[model samples]
Target chain A: MHDRRSFLKLGAGAAVGGIAAALPSAVSATECASNIKWDETRDVIVVGSGFAGLSSALNAKRQGLGSILVLEKMQVIGGNSAINGGWLAIPKNPIQLAQGINDDSPEELVKDQIISGRGMQNTDMLRQIANRALDAYQLCIDTGVKFREGFNQQVGGHNKARAIRTLHGVGGDITTKLYEAGKKEGVEYRLQHYVEDFIMDGQEIVGLKVRQNYRFPDLKTGKTIYIKANKAVILAHGGFSRNLVLRELVDPALDKTLDCTNALGATGEVTLTAMAHGAFPVHMSFIQTGHWGSPDEGGFGWSNALLSIGFHKGISVNVLDGKRFMNERADRKTCSDAIMKNRHPDGSPAYPVVFFNHDDHIGAEEVTRAVRDQIAWKVDSLEQLAKQFNIPLAPLKQTVAEYNKQVPQRIDPLFGRMMDTAVELKPPFIVSRIWPKVHYCMGGLKTDLGARVLHSQTLAPMKNLYAVGEATGGTHGGTRLSSTACLECLTMGIIVAETIKSDMQA
Target chain B: MMKTLLLTLVVATLFTGAANAGDLVKMKGSTQGRSNHEFIYQDGCKGCHQGSGKQNATDAACVECHGEITSIPVDESKLAIPEAHPHKSLHYNQGASCLACHGEHEKKAPVCAECHRTWFKEM
Candidate 1:
């Protein structure tokens, strides 16, 4: 690997002759003065105050990094982690410590993660995350974030009730707790500043050129500031779930289709920035898909009403000409792809609708009051409902009759419905209009076990560059397990911080 | 009789001039709607616009100057609001404002489906 000091010298030369040189002399003088504001140069500079960045900072501090600086882009700290349902799936965690749930070994966790990855996961990275997961889970508890006990249940792949969920609701609560802890520990947080690009010393990254927003009495302006680092720079800037260009570049099929619950700033610019700096991107085709809902009057897609109804274990069918096309019991991704494939004979995109009976609706309503409040349109007769939705009445009637006649039980023989609930037998049947939409991006900048971003060509560490959270790739492998995204952010954040601390000590 | 006629003419001229000037001021005031005025006044819009409050006093007064405004009705039963996608929970309580997420100058609602097609289909 290239030496870090030589890299800084080369960067200084490039800065002098490049864009920094073209600026008006007055502006250049300000930047020079800003660079001198480094109170203490630490071994690592963590970029982002979200879960990953905070975790890295805390770990680095624990590991004895001389000083650490956390730079955040938003006005607040906690990134996306602050906005999520804080469920960290640590198979055997403190709840197990408190309630005596059976212990789960790292090997078993790794095996499950591998299976969930469906053959495309990076084994090395998955192994590292699984091995260190328990420790990370305990770290949150020790730091005063409370977790709910005994409600652990299986979702999607894992066999055990290993999901260690935060009592703080989801992401927001956990992030708040972490933020308070970080503050108490004296982690310097710089908010409302965006890291634009890395300062390169030849092939090694030495620091970052950040743009700070200046709010004046009559004007709002952004001024570029430089931050120099002595150890490493960790990127925790989240994913490209909202970036259409990046999504299209990763998978053309997913272009113009994905729906993200992510914040408006959840663009994959940081990943692109890393790629530009010679970091290789991996698994760009792995897009996560699941149920999503749209407003009836129409504008944007909202949360999946199905999940809101606690129908996670049920089957879903894509009906065309009043018949099922794919297996309802199929996994989320498979079901989404099947629904997208359902088209009319004329090759036009078919409006495949999802059907659930009264029982399913009730179950959903019970789980979430919001779902109950939204059940406004319902009808007893299929013919009348068909007219309302503009579907052919005769075809819909015939399809429901055929479906009702064939099965001895409520379980749809053609498509396996998980719970075997009865069909719409009573009055007031419900149907939701659904079409395949883009959901999540599983591809990003490739990082190693320690969450350090690597040089694309050399496979060596870029002197002061690190990546964590969704911006970094490797943990998900081919496909991601549900709820693991939040877990990865917490676990990897800690790992990167510890690594930076150890590096500084060495 | 000539003096009386002259007095009438003078009164008429002054009234006509005042009416013409008032029309211009009313037009400027109506350009800002009630919500806009409230936002401006509450958010220190007067700090820059100077005398906007006196010009557009009430919501109706603001609408009068701005012309007719169409509002998307909140269908309490729908999971997602029909066209506006107003965060129903937040909006129903009047706890939030349109200007909070959408800037005050926006004349059209954001095309959420252009990027989020799964959630939005051209109706």
Candidate 2:
């Protein structure tokens, strides 16, 4: 590894430093731990309780790790995993093999990912995930996560239909299943325990200092405790899509008005902590924001079903002129950019794009939920719907007429939308006006293919420190394809576990 | 200036045990809860708090103790209502802030009750 570089220069904010640097002002900031007692000791400690964290802890326990600890900052265990849309993009998956679907390979998945990432991603990292897609998928099986069989859907950024999902649709089910599995395997969890500092023995990572019984945003409320790790320390705490200060350090354009799709604890404090101990922070500003989030709801509230259904099958119109300005079936980034680019003359979100579809075109339950949640607008006539949203009636009628005229040709000449049938927009239109919200941070700490956090310039591993999940960057370079994180998380989880196990055995 | 100063990972971490809490190391507040956690509210309180108003118990405090209300539930998951009812909650998981919706001494009302009183039988 090369000499260490400072954190990403995303914006003009304070470079969020490490745990050792975090405390001197707040409490005791001394690295003079030689005189200090080793109050507690453990074989391995994994931070954050998301998919990465649980998988790390599980792998450690399975590999004869007798003394392993999992730490969570929030009152709850699961981070965004419990709330995410349970979609995973995997190549050459068992379900596909069972269905006799050939023409899939690690090379193909890597190609699609690099294409989506614009070649800025870690090809080696992407290659590993694609290659071990089955091994990682097997981890889900060993943990007893029952994925929905015979159910596969294509999303933005993939050249193939290799996505799979759990039968228990909500991320909560996976979180609960992993939590239970970990518990059953004797994996213990300590809630409200936030890791604040890394205890170092010269250049090596020994363990970490923590704040016990911590509450979110209540900075000065918890008590400090230090522990030692004899084997290694792994970070799987996820990203900081919600940590505006740290995010602003990388992405200066982040204003207060934008919303986040993460849980309250998705704020990135761990990345800074890892960096403090000689890890390189990369792609700090490359945050992933999507156009489907509704301003009407907060958190990652469940309108995703409508957004997915409506974005493809529906026509989005400018609220002012009632015209379709973007391809309804464009990729996620394009769809979001089109909505953000076309604005009103007054500099506000002009023509607040409205996605509308006939009743027969979308899922009834999803539509009903959207309507009940007050996110979707329901109306019987095109004129009535335009009136309901204050849209110009004449242009809407013309747009619909033109859309129906183009439907029979089985082609979207305007937007190049890929569809089997160009279904005509009929009466009783269900519409939802959507906008962009911060979803995931594609950039994070830099790491190697083995999931070891590395020194950016030197390109050397930080000895015993491993970073995984969204916390480690280089998997998705420019833009992440939908359903890819699930595969990435599981794959890295296995790699880190196996690497540590072999190292320990040696 | 940053190059001159040594960088240590700002994040903090502590581990007693995860799957096995092997030999758990207790921190300063590990044994404690929110604000004077030693004085069990269930034991009725010390003095001034027993009467009412701002000095009394809160919904946030209640959820702090009974954080796993969803798994156990209030109506169905409750082992015994008289005590568990005080710990029962219906809206904590749906992004409703525990402090925002459940206030006790300030007002004996749940904020979710304003819009969703009809939704929950407990309300």
Candidate 3:
């Protein structure tokens, strides 16, 4: 039996200090001995029942692997993916082709992703995801998922209008459809089964030490049980945005004070557990704050979609000076950076207000609901809007007037924003205060193009260990563009299943 | 005087029984609809708290009394958005946890309200 100190010293590297240090002290003593009694075994085991996890299971089943199991630590099935805005950016998709938009190509999409990612993305991975994007989108449709009728949307940072949303406009729609499809295919799901540690044999991964009937935020609740996997253990556990300790370690600026948009179960324990078992970490410092988050709401609120619309149709102004700060159409990272930098005198976040004219063709239903719920306000005049948020009325009017004048020419002279789709400002504006919130982690276990997790020291692929989605980093570099997360998760999930099947045959 | 003394004794015994029912330690709020209800052997604390506070209230236990989540009647009139019944949510479907919104001993705010509206106080 190896002691806890010796095992951690041997298994972990200096690169994993942030993850290792952030592990709860109570669970630090729980170590997985190499030869543990197995309570159960399966052909394949998938951790975290989000888009990536469910997609991997379905693909594995389709590839003729039997006895697949999907484990979700949360009481609910979908992680953040369920509640996410179900927009998937795919270049040259059917919707785009049908709409006669022929300018888009996978290369063009990759170029935009690279730009949004600040050139720090893995080009190979980005190209791979971009290439298979259409196929991934088709897979969702085949699995009974339906996109919104009429037209596709161009999310921020995308050069083309390539993103398609689900009919219900929430990732839950896609997740529910996929889950139902997987269930019909005999893919087993177990909720509240938390994967705590990986079972290893020599340098290869073997199985998992999981806690069954686990309760959230209660480490001492569930009893420990070991489960064996004959084929592979795929990790699609999303990110650690909700894990304050890990977030603080990587970027001190992103501490507990900032509310996150992730589900409560997105604590990143599986990633930390994998790191404790020699998986290499990548891009740990690149955390993203959503620029559309509202201070009045919690989690991913309705204001998120409205604010996205505001970026195209309106402007975000500073409450103190009533001046436009940055390009509203800029990528999430750029917008968040601008908002954070435009702070109050006390160093608090600026929490700027985004407003668009009520009659500007923005979705009326959403605006009405937001106004009714008090998530957004619909003021009769510009003066009332200024007084509501405490902005100087003169500069507010001047800023809107300048925007209206510049936008008529189809270009923003001050901020370099393209105003081709924008319209002139009108009365009866709808407004919501916007602030940045910890939204996603663009970092996790490092993997090869095959989605096989690499070892920290040897830099070799850890046999029988695979990762996909936000659980594995280097896909989106420094900042992830909106609507691309779904694409990456679906693409990498299929790639992982194929890799595992081929490896097993060999 | 004798009648008053007997009534007080009975009230004290009932309160003590409810407090000592199971792991009521630090459990807050009323069980709403089931307040002041008597607990028998078949459906006491062990009914929902299967392992007794070690695990969350089981969905199966909830189903045993309330019925399958899909079939459970939802009063649309009680909902903020009539279409978004928390139990039969299009997103969660039947997988929504009863404990996520409802608390037995403690007042638990619905997780749905984190993104939506605060409609039901006891949910």
Q: Estimate each model's TM-score.
A: 0.70, 0.75, 0.81
- Alpha carbon lDDT of residue A336, candidate 3? 76
User: Could you give the interface RMSD of candidate 2 in angstroms?
Assistant: 7.3
How does residue A61 of candidate 2 score in lDDT? 85
Candidate 3's TM-score on the B chain? 0.58
Instruction: Report interface Cα RMSD per prediction.
Output: 10.4, 7.3, 2.0
lDDT of each: 0.57, 0.67, 0.79
Write one digit per residue (lDDT tens) for candidate 3, span A17-47: 2332223323433444454778899999999
Candidate 2 chain A lDDT trough over 10 residues, lowest sum? A1-10
Please, what are the lDDT tens digits per residue for candidate 2 over residues A1-506? 10012111111122233111132212223554575466688889999888888788888888886788888876556787766767777778777777777888889889988998987898888988889888877878777677788877666767777888876564554566667788888877777677767777655678787766555545443556778888888999998887866676687655444667777678777787666666898778888886777766655664567877776667788787777878776766687777766567766665354555655755577787667657677888987887887888999899888878887787777777775634677878887767777888888888878887887557788777898999988679988888888788877877898888876787
Most TM-score-accurate candidate: 3
C-alpha lDDT (0 to 100) for residue A124 of candidate 2: 83
Which whole-number lDDT from 0 to 100 does residue A62 have in model 3?
89
- DockQ, candidate no. 2: 0.05
Query: TM-score: which is higher, 1 or 3?
Result: 3
Q: Provide the fnat value for model 3, as a fraction from 0 to 1.
A: 0.53
True-structure lDDT of candidate 1: 0.57
For each candidate, how many residue pairs have backbone atoms clashing (under 3 Å)?
20, 39, 3
Q: Quote the TM-score that chain A achieves in each candidate.
A: 0.80, 0.84, 0.82
Better of 1 and 3 by DockQ: 3
